[model samples]
Target chain A: MIPGTPNTVALGIGAALGLTLAVAILVLIRRDHLYIRQALWWVAVAAVALAVGVFPAGMDYVGRALGILYPPMLAAVIAIVAMLIKILLQDVAITRQERQIRRLAQELAMRAESPSSKDIS
Target chain B: MQDTLIVIPAKNEAATISGVIAEVRAATSLPLLLVDDGSADDTAKIARAAGAIVLTPPLHLGAWGAIQTGLRYALERDYRRVVTLDADGQHEARWIPDLLAVLDGDAADLAIGAFPERGSAARQVAWALFRRITGLGFEDLTSGFRAYNAKAIALLAGEEATLLDYQDVGVLLLARSAKLRIVEVPVKMRLRTTGPSRIFSSWWVVTKYMLETVLLCFAHWNRTGRQRT
Candidate 1:
């Protein structure tokens, strides 16, 4: 309802740009890390939404760029992305734990077979 | 009296080995063989010092493996019977007389020492589950304290008993499958002073034991159609 303000637009654009750059850098550094890559993608989308929510200039740009100005919808998309990322992380963790258990079982069998191993109390 | 060989599976039970050995010696002049299941302590030394013949396995084969090893040794030596007693000081050595008496009377091929009167409620529950699954009506199927005659020794000396992870229930089930007569004799169990029980140590042990017992029951049930009366 207020007049288009340069300061408000600049502040919102600055925050969005900073967050997007940070997420990009994190993704680049941790591309091999599954959980980090997933988290970075969610953060990037959330950063873009936050930018569009505050920056009046971004609203006009989004409408021209994507023909849309629905900032609230971005929040919902970000939440869904975050949930998917969390579930993927949990799956990775469970897989890692199962591998660890297999390794331990193998080690125990080897120890049991080795005659030179120290006796148990 | 027929010569009976007693097999005691000891693991780091040096503190009570001599006493148990002496009591078994005093109760009966049965030849005692102590299978030291790779105890890190002086269990072998003390058992040897107690004048009992000792066999040291290469690794810790656990209670079941140790007893199997001892049974094999007794079978090889041509012992008429083999009695297994705990070296953890929990079982009364004097009750060896009652177990031997039952065996000598030809009342049963296998006489198990039951401790239902002394065990806690949790142990009782475990016992009940084992009985239900294995269809073994014995008061205590998991009782390690037992006496096996020549028929039992020969039957158990086969590949079946050797492959078992736990001997007490597995041996009982195998004996029952072979139609070997099994009798339960009342024996007093004293409190163990050495360490905590392997059963109630934690949930992990309890769950593992339950799973193993259930598997054993399935195995026996599948092999033998007749349930113990």
Candidate 2:
């Protein structure tokens, strides 16, 4: 219901791009390449892309509401910011996993070095 | 079993590991455990031959990680105290008693074996800068030679200390935050006979260390006061 003159060509390209992303994400999730916890974010991103593609004028409304001079730049800015945040979250997850792996490695080494463990071998 | 366990964290120190182990054996009969930090050389084999139980991590855990592994081992064994020695042969075993004595006297929960004479000009500047930022009064802040009582060991072995890459400021800051009694025991250290300094191996590493340490100092300054206790 957003009001704007949406060009047919632009609408077709946007819809195709959104549909491709959505299908790709679903395929990845189905293949078990992406965990549910991580896939949730990608699902939301794909949903957003689909929504924007169906309603390109919505971006204009939001951008104008936010007082942006050029509405199209809003999408670019949001995508960049979202990507940065996603990358940062990945790093946080990596740090936690790294810490866990280190502790596990320590435990393994200690257990292997124990006299009883040596006796078993 | 002796209450105090000597833990040495060595990385590719095959050339010096045997000598260091021998020196420690000569100084004290306390049980020794060497955390072989994924050394490609025969550090583990040599250390075993030298009468030290060695823990070889599946992968490299850096210096602090290796030390923490030993601390965790000591914690699990209910050891009353732990003395950490660097495997570079710099940390002399003769000072082991002095550090343990400080802990035994209940003078401090953590005793740092300090040797200010070891700092070169560049090291002195770095030390001064770190001192100014962190407000730590110890002359030798980066000395790996240290004694930790049970309380300190428990604290450092916990999850809160796993992310620390260096044993210098990050560790001291954690100890400071926990209000552990810390004292410096003057001791002489041997000059490095092997590779270059780990922390100051290159200019790029030095810059990274400085920035990261300064950030750590500022991050904890609010929670932990500038008290020189």
Candidate 3:
């Protein structure tokens, strides 16, 4: 009920957006296009978005309680933080994969160099 | 059988690969492995033709990756020591024995063949900064010419050292953390006649290398402990 709160139309649109995101992610997961580990993050984001949409005043209340001067900025801040964590996690995963690939490449080369039992004996 | 293995990590150094291999072969009968880092040229074929056992990664694994591959190979074959040299002909084959001497004498676990005069002014500045930050006393911090014993090879070839992008500061830091004694032996080096340096190839690469190395130094400051000669 706060001033500048999302109107009914905006709330509906937000809800629809959240619903669409949730459905899209689920379908992607079902099709094996998205990993379950990563889908957990999107699922949480969707849940939060759906909650905020259904209770538009909740964000304002939380924002005010946290002493945020501009309520919508809280969403932006949270979004940015989440994105940062996601990107950092992605880099961590990439680092691990890179290491694994390097080890595999080394193994392959070593195997190719080593003569087979038939040749060695 | 020679207890030492010479590892030369080459990338597109087909022009110099044969000469480098021959030089090492002349210097010592130690078995040499040329880790061809997915070179676009015929580095592998040329090296193989020159009587070197060539190990080519299916894809490019950068400098450190290729070196680590060599280390792993050494470790697997139970080699007592490993000496790594550049394929670009900067590192002198004559100094391999000198580097190994430090290890054999038990004066150090790792021996670095340092030619301080080989670096440009900018490289000197970078080396000074790295020495200041890491407290490593090496004059040639970026020297690829180094000798490592079985102990050092085992540690560096393991998963713990897998993610390192550079074999310079990171390897030194890891060695220090493992309580490995490092010593620098003065050596003569010729100027590289082949491809550009991997680290100082471009201004952007230099900047990135500086930032990443500086950050790495700070991150490992506490764990690396005080430097030892």
Relative to the unseen true structure, what is the C-alpha lDDT of residue A95 in candidate 2, on a scale of 0 to 100?
93
Q: What TM-score, to 2 decimal places, does chain A of model 2 have?
A: 0.87
Give the per-residue lDDT digits (tens) of candidate 2, residues B16-40. 9999989998999988899999788
Instruction: Give the alpha carbon lDDT tens digit for every residue of B92-133 in model 1.
Output: 878988988888999999999987876678888888888877
Candidate 1 off by > 4 Å: A1-121, B226-229
DockQ of all candidate complexes: 0.02, 0.45, 0.42
| TM values, all candidates | 0.64, 0.94, 0.92
Put down candidate 3 lDDT per residue, A95-114, tens digits, no spaces.
89988998999899887873
Best by lDDT: 2
**Ten-residue segment with the worst summed lDDT in candidate 1 chain B?**
B220-229
Q: In what order do the candidates fall by DockQ, top score first?
A: 2, 3, 1
Instruction: List the TM values for chain B, per candidate.
Output: 0.94, 0.97, 0.97
The best candidate in terms of DockQ: 2
How well does candidate 3 reproduce the true complex, by DockQ?
0.42
In model 2, what is the error at residue B15, expressed in angstroms? Answer: 1.8
